[model samples]
Target: MPNEPTASLSPRRLTTLGHSCVLLELAAADGSVRRLILDPGNLTAPLTATVAVDAVLITHPHPDHVDPSQLAALAAGRELPIFGGAGLGSYLSEAGIDAVTELEPGEHEIAGIQVRVGSAPHEVIHPALPLPANLTYEIGGVFAPGDAFARPEGQTEVLLAPTGAPWMKLLETISYVAEVAPQRMVPVHDGGLGPAHRTLHTTVMKKFAPEGTEVSVLAPGQSLEF
Candidate 1:
């Protein structure tokens, strides 16, 4: 696919920051780039000190998906705007982040980058576990579903799919990919797996991916360029 608009995302590339965290860099005409990081949680490394992030977009309130310390650090001294749907404000406030911009399920121009928040229900773990609001994001045409397996509104040229999670089964993973049917699918949310299990799960996803979709495994810190 060709590069999308800078507001929507361009170059169509991303870097894996462990688990469900994905980073997108949008290049502008003036030779500057805007960086957007999603779901920087316990599974990912400390990104504030290393990555020049313009904004942080979160999908949920789960500790594994939203790290307050990281958010505070990322916002320190800079006008780092944090974006997320409902149920994420208290978590940020508890971490001393005073102001957070609420992003409802729709298109938004965040930090000069246009992002679409996917409307997805957070998967259920058990009857007793408290379920909270969840969402997915379409950054630069790459659909990165934080924890849900649901497909979003538009055509997905590239997909950042969750390979393994507590709430999902192997069959569900296969079917999700087949249903989305993006040209490129990268595996995320696999931190729960050891080497052997990771290999097995990824193999199954690759095996069941739609014929034209290529399942790519992006190791932590590794990037994929279009």
Candidate 2:
């Protein structure tokens, strides 16, 4: 069977704003643009001052994934709808933030962009420690899986694959990209790596990623069009 249109008519642009935080500017059929931010934690000055974000999506409530101070500053007194896992709402509320929409694993439309939410239990750090819920967002064909290894329910063209984290292993990360089989893979969740480690990780990813898959690592302020 021929492939169906993935999501919107216009092309989508994915920008890495440092770490797992990404800014996606999606084009509408009407020639307009809509911006959605995924995991706006540890946002850099370039992302904050330049990008005009329409909405925010959180994959989890981890400070690295949803830094309260950065989130507050990003809101800029505007009532932006923050979408995330069911627990994020309460977590944000406790932090004096109220503009959140809890999401389950399903489809919905927010800020004029089509969204499908998926989830998995966060990777175990310790056997006794309880795992927090992690969300995977499929916005158009751009898949951002937060910190979890859960795959999206539909086709993914551009995948924001996690590269470096406490819960991630090099072999497992490679296997994830192979399983998803996206046309383009951008490395994320790599804020903790230094320059040397970053280079080593990138080399391994390029060498081991599925054949014909394009794995590109975006710098803090870099953007990739898909």
Candidate 3:
């Protein structure tokens, strides 16, 4: 066999945050870069320290997924747009954030980019009180399924997914990626947690990844181009 030609079908670049934080940069035919931060949990330190973002696509409002106070830092100094499910609007308003826009499973355009919100399941354990309206966001060939994982029907070049311990079951994560069928899949929501929750990092990749899925386990403070 000729190595299966993996390079031709893989993502161009990828950066992993210690605990499931990922920043994916996609190259547009027009030569501009479309950057997306999925589930920006506890990203305040990282963003302030080194990284600049153009836009943020939030899938849900879990503390690990959407760190309001920290995310606000990115919105500061520059006018960055934050897009999330309807629930995000309320949270943004309460946080006194002016640049946040909430989407309700529809198509939206921003900064010359097209974003589509797909459906996802919230925490099966606590489906009500913190009832999150999870979203599967597709923007410029990148798909991010915050914490939920009901695969959207479409073709995606890269997938930023939750492979951490708290958010999903190992098998469920594997099944989601299998269904979506992306050219490349990167794991998130991993070590962002504390010592008591480290096992999630191991289990996700060990148990969930499908046979053919390409998985990248990124270290904190690292970045990639795709």
Candidate maximizing lDDT:
2
Residue lDDT tens for model 2, 56-160: 899888877887777766677777788888789888898898988888888888788888888888887778977678888888788888877878776688888
Please, what are the lDDT tens digits per residue for candidate 1 over residues 28-95? 44556778888888877675646667788888878778887777666667767788878677767877
TM-score of each: 0.90, 0.90, 0.77
What is the per-residue lDDT of model 3 for residues 117-195, given as tens digits with 9 covering 90 to 100? 8877775655455567888878766677766676656877777766555446766767778787777776666654565
Off by over 4 Å in 2: 1-10, 43-49
Q: For model 2, what is the error of residue 165's alpha carbon versus the real structure, in angstroms, after optimal superposition? A: 0.9
Which pairs of residues clash in candidate 1, taking residues 3 or more apart in a chain or in different chains?
A: 7-114
Q: What are the lDDT scores of the predictions, listed in order? A: 0.78, 0.80, 0.64
Per-residue error for 2 in candidate 2, Å, reads: 36
Task: RMSD for all candidates, in order, please.
Answer: 4.3, 5.6, 6.1
Judged by lDDT against the true structure, how good is candidate 2? 0.80
Clashing pairs in 2: none
Off by over 4 Å in 3: 1-12, 18-20, 43-45, 49-51, 127-129, 192-208
